[model samples]
Target chain A: MSSVTTTPVPRPATVARPTGRTAPVLRQLLLLALAVVVVAPFAWMVTTSLKDYADVYRPPYLWPQEFHVGNYGRAWDAAPFAGYYVNSLIMTGGILVGHVMLDTLAAYAFARLRFPLRNTLFLVLVATMLVPQFVTVLPAYDLVIRLGWYDSYAALIVPRMADVFGIVVLRAFMASIPAELDDAARLDGAGPWRSLWSVTLPLCRPALATVGMFSFLYAWNDFLWPLLVTSDDTHRTIQLGLSTFSSKYGTYPELLMAGTVTAAVPALVIFLFLQRAFIRGVASTGLK
Target chain B: MLAPTLVVIGVFVVYPIVGTGYLSLTSWDGFSEIKKWVGLGNYTRLFRDPAFLNSLWVTVLYGAGVCVAGVVSGLGIAVLLNGAFRGRGVYRAVFFLPVVTSSIAAATVWRYVFGDTGVLDAVLRFLHLPAPNWLGDPSLALVSLVLLTAWKSLGLNVVLYLTALQTLPADVYEAAAVDGASRWQQLRRITVPLLAPMTFFVVIEGLITSFQSFDLVYALTGGGPLGGTETLGFLTYREAFRLSHFGYGAAVAYTAFALVLGVTLIQWRLGGRERWSS
Candidate 1:
């Protein structure tokens, strides 16, 4: 029976004979339907963003009567979006730098080095990942105020610089590297820091990219923390700015849609270009 | 090297968690020097507060709705895109688009979709169907929130399920097919059981994450239409920031945190013992 099962027999007829004729057609049809559900809201947003007042609220929805391209400009001018953009870029950049550096150092230590309480400390770090953000933001707010960091970049960037998830991802990636490489570096008169920088760091680029992408996305998309810390437009990030914009111009659906489009496009563009890496990164990480 | 990370975590995460616990036991208005020890008073009041109870109930309902819907739809899409096919990348990309979009931006568009003269209303009018207010009615408001969240969660679930599906042994399916098993039969018999571990992960993760959903509620409804959509997270925001009930808000946050921890612990217990045995 084992010999018969292992025998090389062309099983094309058996595998494809039943559903071969119509499976692809059915699959494509189902896929197209799901795709429409995902894309319709975005289509509605873009078309409505360009509509004049009448077309926005017209009976037949989705497409506008005419393309009023000035709405983006009007929406941009309606608020301090330029300042918000600068602030967001600064905050995201600061966070990425801090997050990558700190997480890399710590992850390298956890992965390669031997120290007292190493495993225990790592377990404690892992446990922190289970705490929800809402639980921390309240006291984090109080801390921000007490530290005189409120309404400043420190409040926005410092606390989020090093996350447990990023460290876990990096540490796992680092652990896969051969111990001989660091040993080789040490034999060449390089200290631990030197080896980590010149040897381990170069090879860990892919993991670093994953960590960077996630940190960028987190810092950029974060709303609640920024909302709690920042009090005015000077330090407001894009999401906060967009929220304020919508609340202030609640009646102007067209402009609000335009503003919405503006806010969403940067992240969408990045993901579109880097989706393969993004998907793989998230998949391999296996927990979000 | 770990010092900086330890310091940051200790200052921000660990301290905040302990602080949240301590804060819950006091009565503070967020400004005064006095904490006025309440000793579980807020927790007791929380059980009786109609608004708090409503929010707790709403959160559970919304979380369950998103978890079930997101997992089912995500599995469906993953199965549809499982094998190699033309336009597979396009379909995956399109479905994954909302996951990348910020909640505020997505919620802004959804607000219009559920608005009075919005897309849903227009479609209903064309079909001559009754168009109840999507975001206006209390009951319907929660449904709309579920729809938005589940949509946002779809891409992540699809990716996860697809990853797990790819790891499944193809020979099992081949053997089942040779035994005259139908596609539906193979899925029900072989694929479902094989993917149970992933399904468990997705479900638990979905519940924990959904309980903390705040951006959509903040942007889309502001927990509004007469507090119809106030989730526990939204309620925490209202109590602490809007109402200045710092102690009470801490209690609410702690309760939400506790639920998350409980689910996580359960996942570890069941998930560990199962040993990916499926």
Candidate 2:
């Protein structure tokens, strides 16, 4: 049981020995159930969002009677959602830009450059991923206060701008780039930065897209860090803004659903657009 | 090139971790001009306090529930999907939907579903069955949370498993069949063993994500129903933010961090040494 099965050759699941007709039926049935478990709550969310406040608890119809489109408007007006959207956009956008620029440079250097203490530094950063964010939550807040950055955009944007996972993922991706490309550029007299920009960065578009999409989704979805850093309502992200609605009007299922729907739309849209790349990046880069 | 990223990470991540270690040794209310030195006092108090210990137990239980349930169910679903099937893309997409949705949003939706006589009950009623109040029951709330966590996070595991399953060679299984191996024998001997890497990958990633994650639980239960679902992460947030017991809170947070760290290191050693020996 402890042995590692090093199956280096390709295996296309030859065990597909025909288990007869019943197996396929059973498998499809199980798959349908699993799909429902994953999807039914989301469908319920949309249904509840449209239901009248009274209809939410009555029978849970698949479709609301009137399909109240006004709930979105009411949910929006219930909190400082417009301000939250702006703050979230700025916070996520700023963090994504910072992460892509910084992590790319750092990863390129870690993968390609000859630098002193490089392995030690890279290991230190990677090890931090195992360190729970809460361990640093209080001290990070103290640092924010010391810098007079409490409740400011910088507090939310700066501390998490350099992520361990980003550097690791980008480094793994960049490690695949042919060294000959760099040598070719250097022979033509391009400096390191020029070579990186002209020769290396173009090949890293897939990695960049993956990293950018992940960073954007993470910063947008984050609740705890944003909840800690920004106490000001004006600086609240969508998560904090939705929390306000929850605390005040949580029992109102329709309003909660509406608010959640509004908050999830951006990420859902992003996933719809870049899901293939997202899955490939997540599955491939984390291991080999 | 490395200077900017290194500087930010040092100031933001590395410095704060070191500072937290010192802060955990003292009792400091986040505000005020005084920091009292209470070396080992917080740790000793934390060890004895039943509430903190309970949260620790709850965190472990919750983490275990998530990893085992997520990994097993995810693998089952992935293998099923790997079969020749219609609507594979739609099934895959739907299963992966919750992974990308915001936690608050997912938790919010789940809270409604699990609320008293909520959609889950309605579904059960549609089937003419009894439906327990998942979120309101003390005995069931944590289970409910785990189910929700798995619901939201298991898609990533499924995708990983599917990716791994796709790499299996049909020829080996055919050879096993020719050698008179039954389907169960092949699955037990070959399929299960081969899937170990993906299993470890799923479990490790699941632990990291679910153990550290608080938003879904916080948003859904608020550590509810007699603190039955009170995770250490939630406890730390409440202590530091609501009570402003910054030092005590930091101690609790670091304890949770250390536990995860220890588990991860053990896993690494076990997995690494076993592979080397093999």
Candidate 3:
């Protein structure tokens, strides 16, 4: 039986040989050169972070003459990084939690629930994605002030909790799940919330992870909103705190580099752990 | 229930948007208790305002430059990295490092690199080339910002495109090779068409992100050298936050929002359907 299947296979055909061996070598060299160009700046950033103040000012040192490990410590001392870390953690966590719960629930409703204006509401939510965040900045600031959330965690956390992008992405994913599962659960006397919690949520882990990671990253790296809403150092997120360091002691390149590395560590850590999910999220949502 | 989510979005997101649209029609100092309806006065003023117009042009140029460079470089890097090579994983990680970093920190580092006595100038001088002060010169400041934006965003696009590239079937390349296709022909005929959806993804994303760019401009240029690098987002920030022209700021914000909305709608109409079908 195996010989019978194999007897009909066609033999391989000969293709034209390479005109020159140097072409592949040249291609490899070009690729490596491109890789170096792409990666050199980041290397420069890390090297500069380790250099002394004088070394930084010196002619474009590709590598540090001496590693100053103390720059990290000094940068920590130069700013309220501990406080910034706390604020950033709380803000990122709050936004992530709110997004996972609120968006998932809304996504569930949009995907499965029978209701009036369901399609209309989903379209409205998706339409909100086009409204650039800048358009709402001023009025949102005023609203925050009126609500007395200025310089408070509430201002930083609450306004961005239920994002339209999050809702749309989650809803799209949730819509792809089979409706029969929800029907089966409903037949078994499960309510909508219970059915979602029991049946739908487990299958939606990848989508949840994607949305959660994005929400966390956005909240972590956000600069303008935090800068506008929080004036006090205590409420400053990591991005704002790093900006403060730059404005206050930008002349101190070593210290600024140190602070920058510190500010960047968390996002890097998250990306390292969830890099695959993050990439998928970017591709699927078309967010860069 | 969905009610709470709807309410939050409505009050925090929807209401503010409506309020901004309303404020665009008025002229009021942020601190003043009075606001006068200005109708098309602000729009007319914006049209006549050379600084605003300069900012608009700079923004368009910056957005276009960054989008083109970012997508092309990102696609190239993604395809290069997608090949079978040792330590490819490590290269992927290294390339993605900048994407994970905070934009403020990235901008700060870039500011130093583009400073008057910085490494970039030193390199140019060493090569016997003219090195204009990048961020300091009005002519170069917006380009400098664009370069920084592309550099900072390169990692995200690479990772995004890499993910899309991995999804392409291996047999497609093998089939192309069997058809007597050279590497360049194979790439142009098979790879480029297959990557169209991802390209569209990157373009739309690049547009939205570039339109709302604020952090790098704020940190690097402060929209300076006579507002040479002032984008719509930064301009809105200045008018609302710095100058306390809250009403005017609100108007600028609405205009930017409208522009972004318009562009995105066109992109969706043109590209999105093909992408979805594919």
Candidate 4:
């Protein structure tokens, strides 16, 4: 009865009942196998990070014979990774902060405030999503240079704040909030800012979180722009810092794997905590 | 309210796009004062440039391979998860892990997995089976990168499909069950037809994302043993950054943009009501 209750479909009284329990069992088993395929690479990545060069070459076996705990340390010493991590943290924080603040305000205005050319502006924003980042990078690079921001954190964070994706996402979530709330807030003598802060902002948490999570991930993993802007080691991010292993120590698989593992952990941790936001971001954005 | 957004987009997104288009028709090395106008020269050179041509071919192959393989595998996994199950949440999370992992980091791990003395070869040797260099051969390298790309991107597809499946009303399945239709028959008749909209959306999104494929090549092959793995994304970077040919790079970027826009437009026109993901 419990199993029957949990089943997705209710069998109609007129239906001829077939053996359904075994079918679910088989499906579950198949899913488990597929899950293993999806997860094996990450498992290998971690296992190999602790692996010695010899054990790595002996790859039929995934578990290391002895944990070389020092690989992380060695990898850390091999490059200025500490500096890179700090820079990455700052860069990710700066970009996401701008994205969340600017996008939420814009989305609120679009959703509730009266303005001329609003619909046209929204359409232009939607169209911007279709343009690839490569097309914009060249001119943005020119702008950054003219502003004398090359090799600075602003180079990584500033232009990225103009996020059409975030604007659309925020607008979508804001539109779903009933206009009646804004009207009621206005009747209660709340200005647009007050209503946004008290009613709308509270409601927009999930959507804001979604945009924050994605743009943070985008800033964290960005490679090319960082490489283009920085001529020196001053403002290096984790992704750009990762190149030392390839350029200087290509022979050291252990170090490369360890550095990759180190570089990946923060993003993974963020994703784990923000998994729901990430899924909602992908799902609602797509379905819309 | 709109002043800030307009200013930012005008300065960054809108102006940048126009500038890029104009830059594609000129010659500039990114740092110099001189930008010589050369209309259609860059586009003509793109076709004649064997390296660029090879990359276009490679990108088309990679994009198609990843789309087909990723969608099929993702739908299969999603279907499996849709059945009554224990630990479904855990399974779903486990599957989605790769989509969050950095592309560069994922490619770096795959390099070892597919490299000469890497994981696959060792496993094959232990089992006394053949292990061809997965990333060595030009053709195989393209295939290998496609495999990695699909693996990295599959989680998004699965999650999307799962959401779509969940939103499907349960009564249809119940009705089918009452009629004694076989599970596969119900899937074919009801599920596939109903899922068409979701399928169309996923494919368009997938194709758009695939056109931006560059990080994998940068991390794994660097466009490879004899330009075998050079992709349009990589070519764009190489033209502007490596060679300092900003104008040419802008042109390569435009070509990619047009290619993506054309295919998307065609798919929009012809793919309406077609059996896309199937």
Candidate 5:
């Protein structure tokens, strides 16, 4: 069950294909054109961020005549961004840690444990995937409010800590792991928890990393729930901070662009580092 | 061991969903002391409400536009990037960058681009083309939102399709070519058929994500320009949080949920069988 090797397809014969040399040149040009389209908005974003207000409104300066490096400082000072950053970091970190620990434990139980009603419960957990988060916003909001967790990190971080998708992915990966590992641990007088901690978790690193990356990205970029839960500036995430920038400084396109760039940097960094896993995660969802 | 998961799911996911269904039938104004049962009243009102109907239409349109555009362009770009090429990795990285960027940030940048005096408008002016106010105009607001969503989501789709393309068995294509199949025929017969599962996956995921489009519209249009861009999700957000109409908002949300669920179920029933066969 652990390994199902797929037969590799034989590579095509190395018959020297005589294509017009211009074909490669043309393909290069076309690919570059595609890349330009893809990168233009981002380039525009960075360029606009460097532009002053006058340069911003002046026919979309392709390059800033006078690059205002101070725009980053101005954008920082434009809102309680420091507080928002700390709040976002803490919330994302808390949610990531909670998800990795809890979801892994749950996945282990679902995949390896022969508990009563396990399949039924796992089915129910998968069914939860069909219900979009929007359906529960009101009740969740009510829960937060009733628990007096509104405008707090508890509201922001706690409910999403146990994600169904994380459990599903982890369970899928865990199901491939041989039960002999757990059995050996049990034979060594290890408890279920000990077997899980010592034997199972170590082997589930790839799945765990995928789950962790996704959880981090989700928590980092989550907007509506945070916006709905936390109204106070002190508890606002970076998204809320950027939105505030938009509303307060609606006229300063350059500053807003700078703030947007600032807000995006962390996610960009994560994507750059864990790109392969991130791409795999995205493709695994079959959302291509 | 499974008890923790069962409890959490039951408490968080199942309970809230059931609670939402119950709330949708109540006259709870979100801050009220007395909760009166209003069986189906919220649903009935939702049908009659012009705002709800319009938002529903907007959501459908947005979903369709994004699905069609994102999937097609994603596949096209993926196919283009499939061949061994110089700097392919960089192009892949650039294409997938939007997936990594925060949606709000992407929307903000797009909002600037779509601004009346922004780069897009300037370009149009340079080309002597008509430049409509994208988010500011009622007619183009939803269209602009759809465009932004497609742009932002295209990267993920590209990566997914690219992965699918690269993983295709080369022998299948070689056999097709041996049978005097042209490139177009090979792509149509072999590639597309083999990619059916990936395509279905893209459609379902695209539908889900497109339906839940909040951040882009929220950041760029705020469902503005006479609520032209107001999706059901946005409407629910406005009603529940902004207007404090919790019961009605819950009903709207449930309505959207039901629609998404119904569509997903249909896709599953239709596509899942085909996937198994393939």
Candidate 6:
């Protein structure tokens, strides 16, 4: 059940291949071409975001003769994008802080602490992962409305504060640490809480980073839940804001591209910085 | 320590699921206090609803399209990048970029790319080809949606394939090579069969993702061009949120849940069979 291991398997010596000079070059060129194909739309996005309205509708829409960075500003002003940004940041921050703290404690208990029905409880938590988020959306919406959390930060944050995937990933990482550390901590007069904060946590930095990155990405980019709960701009997120913006200004590719680019920047920047953890962590978990 | 986590899950996840089940059995307009007992009426109407039936068919098409294309292309790219090479990390990151980007952003970019005089149309025009209305055509709209989904998901598929590819024992390939198997033959006979588990995993993952696909349809097509892209997930959104038919929406959502569960069970059995066959 501990499926979050990231260790690379040892490869046999026979796997090494003798390649001709042209073969490697060909492979590089081929992969490079494919990469261009993948990156071309993104490149188009950034360039189009800078183009004037006429250039966007122009034939062979490759390059812009002049750059209009004002599109970003106009797009920003065209909607309550600043409010959306603030709401998104606050929502993501709340979800991240609460989610990580709660999941860390739960995972620590599951991985280390001995308790009654621990296995049963952990299995119950893991089974929740199979229940698609949408399966609960209708009822969850009702629940939020009943609690009067709709169109508020509480609606956005509280429900998302507990994720089984985070717990599972963190638990697997914590379990892989040698149990001798806990005993050593006990010899030094440290309790479970002290040991968790001072010993186990320091060693689980990579896993924590991985979990944190995932939480950030999910909260930041989430569209459906936010859309369902927040009916107004006050609690609306960037993803929702961008959708509304696209619908209103459907014909304005320049402004639309600008808005989309603005919405995408935070996630892209975060991924740029933490991609090592992001990709590797995703590879390890593979379940989600 | 587990109290907070358990409470949140119990209230948010577990309770809502049970609540969704109960709500599916009653007809409740979202605002009304009175809940009318429908007793499978929504399910009956759902089966007879042409809109619901169309969405079901569209979802299957989109899921199958994304799964097949994503798996094949992802495997091809992963095999290409499997060899030790310069700048492998950069390539991997480039490929995985879309997987991390917001779905709305990806869909928006694709909406433009698929629009008339967009990037794809420009390219096709340059090559002296007619650019069909990719987004406005009833048949082509869903195809465009499928392509958009495939692009967004290609990265995950590649990464999954790469992870599986790395774990394959080189000794099997060595044995195949010793038996005078050609490079392509070695890949066909050894690499592919060994990666079947990942393929199955990816297929199931793809189906689930596609089945719940909403943001793409919402942003890309808006379930438009004659409702060609109205996936079950989108239909659920419309019935419940837009129309305020809470009960019917829950029924649609439950049907989706059942489909996903059914697929998983089938995959589980097939996986067991694969293990036995191996």
| TM-score of each model, in listed order | 0.95, 0.92, 0.90, 0.92, 0.93, 0.94
- CA lDDT, candidate 2, residue A77: 85
In the predicted model 3, the residue pairs found to clash are none
For candidate 2, the clash count comes to 9
Query: How far off is residue A124 in model 4, in Å?
Result: 0.4
Write one digit per residue (lDDT tens) for candidate 6, span B1-278. Answer: 88899999999999989988889999998879888998999999998999999999999999899889888989999998887656887888999889888999999999889988678987888799998989988779999998888888888888889988999998888888888999899889888888888888888888888888988899898898888999998998999889999999999999999999898889879873553233
- Give each prediction's DockQ, rounded to 2 decimals: 0.58, 0.50, 0.50, 0.51, 0.56, 0.60
Q: What digit string (tens of lDDT, one per residue) describes model 1 on residues A36-139? A: 98899999999888999777888556778788999999999999888998899999999999999999999999998899999999999988887878899888
Model 2 spans with C-alpha error above 4 angstroms: A1-23, B83-85, B272-278
Q: Which regions of candidate 5 are displaced past 4 Å?
A: A1-23, A285-288, B274-278
**Per-residue C-alpha lDDT of model 1 across residues B1-278, encoded as one tens digit per residue:** 88898899999999999999999998888878999899999999999999998998888898889889988998889999887655777788888899889999999999989988788888888899998899989889999999999888798999989999999998999999999999999999998888888888888778877788899999989998888889998999999999999999999999988888787778768763353332
- Cα error, candidate 3, residue A112 (Å): 1.9
* Count of clashing residue pairs in every prediction: 0, 9, 0, 0, 0, 0
4 versus 6: better lDDT goes to: 6
Candidate 1 vs 6: which has more DockQ: 6
Task: Candidate 4: list runs displaced more than 4 Å.
Answer: A1-23, B169-180, B271-278
Question: By the lDDT metric, which is better: model 2 or model 4?
Answer: 2
Which is the winner by TM-score between candidate 4 and candidate 6? 6
For all candidates in order, the CA lDDT equals 0.88, 0.83, 0.81, 0.82, 0.84, 0.88
Q: Please report how far candidate 6 places residue B195 from its true position, in Å.
A: 0.4
Best candidate per TM-score, number?
Answer: 1
A-chain TM-score, model 4: 0.87
Residue pairs clashing in model 1 are none
Q: What is the interface RMSD of candidate 2, in Å?
A: 3.8
- Every candidate's TM-score, chain A alone: 0.92, 0.89, 0.89, 0.87, 0.90, 0.90
Error of 3 at A192 (Å): 2.1
